[model samples]
Target chain A: MKLFSLEYGLFLLSVFYIFYLLPHRHQWKLLLAASLGFYMITVPLYVVVPFTICMVSYVAGLLIENTGRNEWKKAIFIMSLMVNIGILIFFKYVDFLTKSFFMALGALQSHFFQGSAFIAAPSPFNILVPLGISYITFQGIGYTIEIYRGNHRAEKNMGLFFTYLMFFPKIYSGPIERAHHFLPQLHERKTLDYELVSDGLKLIVWGLFKKLIIAERLSKVIDIVFQNPDHYAGIPLIFASVIFLVQLYADFSGYTDIAIGSANVLGFKLTANFNFPLIARSTTELWRRWHISLSTWFFEYVYNPIAIAKREWNQWAVIYASLVTFLILGLWHGASWKFVVFGLLQGVVLSAEFLTKKFRKIISSKLPEVVNNCIGVMFTVLFFSFSLLFFKAGNFSDAAMMARHYFIFTGDESRIYSLFQAFKLSGVLKLTFLAGLLLAVEYLDRNFDLKKVISRQAVVLRWLIYYMVIFAILTFGKFQQEQFIYFKF
Target chain B: MTDADVLKQVNEIFIDVLDNESIVLKRETVAKDVEEWDSLTHIQLIVTVEKHFKIKFTAAEILKFRDVGHFCDEIIRKLGAS
Candidate 1:
């Protein structure tokens, strides 16, 4: 279910009230039952797949824990990993792989047979992907991997492991909770604190404003340009590309805010996934701030192992690790060549940064810190925005055309005139006003901690502001259901 | 070997790998204290230390060394054990 939907709102209200009345010990059972109900609500048949995965992983964890210092535990861990990964690959990538293989074979055959074409019908056995399969699957594997590494002891209780896996707030799109950090907090007594609740409510409101008001509004403008870039020229495409970045950031991060806030309201603190990535001064810094949980996961599980394995290669090992890790990470988004290209772009940039770190440091040290930071921020955002060409494009040709035309100096000489031509005064002005307002809020929040200041404000003033915000949401919010961009991943 | 002797050797390795003769090491030094000592250099430093000391570290042990002091302690303990 969509977090912003009326159904979810009503469901949460009922759950919150019921949760409020429950004693601490029984809360896990309620959550597990509610999680089952939530999955059943999304897709009834697919519940079997995720439930089976959780139960299998739970058994694997138990088997690993009991067979200490035995070879069977290693075999069991490998078996569990294979089952989880095999399911993901079969469901997500099999078709992509099959099509790709045929396309390659067709290309080779074309050279031998003059009139031959590579054409094959797609497979008929269509499988419906479960909503939170990747997330839960990763958590399940991470649990067993931790057990194998001796970093974590397996959870003895079956229900608790299921509760940990199916924590519904983070189920669909995740902060990808670790078993060690998250499992301990599940059993703690959670009496509602009014301050925490208010903070949670504020975060939810802010997240909604970003999604409904900013991202949705921006999506309309971006769709016009991206859907048919042939109709548009340089500045319009450029504007759309920049706006798409904002829209995506707002969309994904907005979802995260609501997830974290909802968890916070229930006295469960999920880890943050984003941290003002747009303002980051370098690609490395940007990655550290953007989708932090996923990046950390790859760093821990993928990159570190590869680098450690190839430690003798010095800098080459790091380069190899960065490329492989990011390539896999990109493929994780979806089964598409475009996503591969997107991942490659990031990998190449990171690899280059590793090679040129000292040189860049010397150059950066020459400039004043503030000036250096500004230039760094500009380059980082521009580089990222440019690479997203593959991510937003229809196919390689359109993306190539966009990139080919990105440097065109002839089309619409004045950038200002082009923007005016592309957007209506009201549309442009409204976007500018809202964007400026958002920047103000972000600035205050980042620099001075806006939440703390808000807490200190007079009660009447606070209520007035709250009412005004509610009125604004009613007046200007987008009412249509727009799925979050990360849901497919 | 003494802490000072290991520190001197580490300083030499840092200088050799980073190609900067002016580099020095301190007990308090962390990754951020040296611009050249990123993740790539980090593993190289560890592997070099392992080769130099003729000892191996588990992944967890390698991860436990938060700074030069922690690293020195691990190296000393391993040397004493050997």
Candidate 2:
């Protein structure tokens, strides 16, 4: 079920109450049952593959841990890595690979016959891609590697380890929990506190407001503009791109908030994935903040190993490593060539920054630091907006068309004027009116503990604010679109 | 050699590799404690240490060092083994 849907909301509410009623030691069992139930309900037979992966990795972790021979341990590690990564590739990339193979064959076949004589179209294979397969598989691989590295001990309990992999809150789109961080916490028998419940509820409310009001509404217009950018020009393209950047932020971060909030109520703490990424002053810094868990996964698993292997190459090593890491990061988002190009662009930009830090430092020293930061923020936002055009577009050609329209401004004066006329400051204001309210609360909540601040206010004032927000949500909310934006990934 | 001697040599290598001469590493110091020491510059630091100390670490050993003290411990162990 979509996390924001009414059905899932009822599920979470009932699950939360049922969880605390259980004896402390049995709490984990309740969670495991809930997790399995959630998976079964949402994905049906798709659950078997992940269950198999979890079992394989669990056995692999134990073997690596128990084996006294170092050679065997390393062999076991590589075998486990291959199996998990192999599963990921087979499931996630099969359709892409199949289509690509058919296209290539079609090209070769078309050469023998005249242009319209031959066509090869492969039927799209419908694979039941399990929920959070990438996330759980990565977690499993990391666990195996950690065991071999002597960093973490293998979990003796199969059930607990399985629960960690199948944990339902993060199953759709994860702040991919590392084994070392999440495993020990699972053992703690939690007694629910009133404060924890309140905080969790507040965060969930805020997350819902972000998704239902801002992101869904913005997506309607974004879908129209991106779907047919050739029909529009200049300002509309720019406007759509900018709005899209914010919409993605609102959607992804809102989902993350809800995930973290739900886990918190359940007395588990998933890592924070987004930390005000839009406010980041530099692209490098933005990457560090955005999808932090995934970024760390790449840095630790992909970049560091490659860098160390090429250590003698000096900074060239850094560039090579970063290029590979970001490309994989992009590919992880989807199986399209668009994602490949998007990643290549990021790797190029980031490598450029690394190579020219000395020159950039010299350039920056001439400006005031605050002014430099402002410029950096502006540049990053524009660059990010440009890159996401590929992510948002139907394909590479659409992205190119949008980019062309954005820069060429070749439409007739009447068309241009009408496009400009279509831009309504008031329309955006109306759509984002509740959005603005949410963001203002978020801003206040940033520097200080907003809940604590609200706690100290008169009870009537606090209730008034709460009631007003809830009222607005029920009255003005777009409950129609319930799927979180990241579920596809 | 004791960890103290390794620490002295490693401290100089950190200063050179990180390009920050003011760095004074304590036993508990990790990557986050230093501003210039990030994952990108990490291998540079490791390679510099191996060159200066004339020792090598395996790929697994390379990623397992937890802090400066843990790094020094590995260096000492390697020196003794050699």
DockQ of each: 0.46, 0.64
Which candidate leads in DockQ? 2
Model 1, range A1-489, lDDT digits (tens) per residue? 888777877777777778878998888888888888987897788888778788889999989989966699889999999999988888888878887887787777887887476566467355677887888888888888888877788898889899899988888989899998889988688788778777887887888888878888888877776777565556666666777788888888888888888877877888889888888888877887899888888887888888888877877888999999999988888888888888888999988877887788789879999998999898888788877888888887787777666666565532556666667778778766766676678778988888888778999988788788777777788868568888888
- Per-residue CA lDDT of model 2 for B21-70, tens digit only, reads 79999999999899778777788788888888799998889888889999
Please estimate how well model 1 matches the true structure, expressed as its whole-model Cα lDDT. 0.81
> In candidate 1, residue A119 scores what lDDT?
68
Docking class of 2: medium
Q: Which pairs of residues clash in candidate 2, taking residues 3 or more apart in a chain or in different chains?
A: none
Whole-model lDDT per candidate: 0.81, 0.83
Provide the TM-score, chain A, model 1. Answer: 0.95
TM-score of candidate 1 on Cα atoms, chains taken together: 0.92
lDDT at position B65, candidate 1: 74
